[model samples]
Target: MKLLSRAFATAVAAGAAAALVSLTGTVGATAAGSGTAAAPALTQVADEAPGYAVEDFAYPDADRILAEQGIVLKRGDGHITLAACGSETGLLEVWARSKDKVCFRVSGNGGYLSLEIPSVYGVKGNAYATEVTMTVEDEEKSFDIAKNTWTPVGESADPNGRDHMLVEIRATR
Candidate 1:
């Protein structure tokens, strides 16, 4: 697949979208699903292959991505990551087809905070509704993924939110 930038969002593909996949940088946007004569449309972060991958990202910029403070990628999950980064969340969303959602937050002194995945969890190792570990007031707490872990953030103050949030690959196996 042909990796690209936001310019691809407006590029009128020349030939059949049979070779490379272009990127619009606009998730859920119109160009997120375009193809090129070079390769088929990007179906996911990586096609059905297995290999080592790495991606680095920074705060969003109008031009090419500048200096990045964070990086994310899949060390397992079966797919080899070519393009390794996107957006400011600093979480490398690894998937295709499905619109994935990832939430990141850190805690300094918490009441009730949330921990979410950037992609679908709980279905293998990458399910979006994965579990969250809460340590409040030096006390360990657990929230069921069914009710709370799915919510990116909470409204009420019954629990506290995250502080030094850093959303990256959960593990690098």
Candidate 2:
């Protein structure tokens, strides 16, 4: 697929160059007939090629999230999007670190995302069948979240109330 895209781009560039050369020749011929008209300068045509391919798992707002909320969002499939917590109803709520809550809005029939928010202890789910993964120290844990309700996870789920980082969330219809 990558090779095909590159080849297509190369073909487009070659076509543009050919068009420029032909246009320059036409202008030169017209100018030679009468010294009145100035020969137009040769200009490279603009590329109409498509944008670079996107990585499916790349986080779109990782830097912005880190800067605004002090959370390092990693990679996700884009089904889940960051939202303003508690401000809207029916959104997934995540409690982490110093931030009061980092929110996510789920869409489509299912959603899957990976992120990094330290000291997560609780989450409130929406209408999707939800699952979340968290990590603490050398141990990792997974929790099944109740839909349309608040469910304690991470440190809250742990018997010792150990601090943990929310790592991933997957939701399905």
Whole-model lDDT per candidate? 0.30, 0.82
Q: Runs in model 2 with CA error above 4 Å?
A: 1-56
Cα lDDT tens digits for candidate 2, 32-111: 44423465689867778668985778787688878977877787777888887667788988876557788898888888
Candidate that would win on lDDT = 2
Q: Candidate 1 residues 1-173, lDDT tens each?
A: 24565447446453223223235333233443533224347658766689767543322331232223122321223221223344333232322112233333212221222222222222112222333433434444333333222233221212444322212222221
Q: Taking the candidates one at a time, how many backbone clashes does each contain?
A: 22, 0
Best-matching candidate per TM-score: 2
TM-score of candidate 1 against the unseen true structure = 0.21
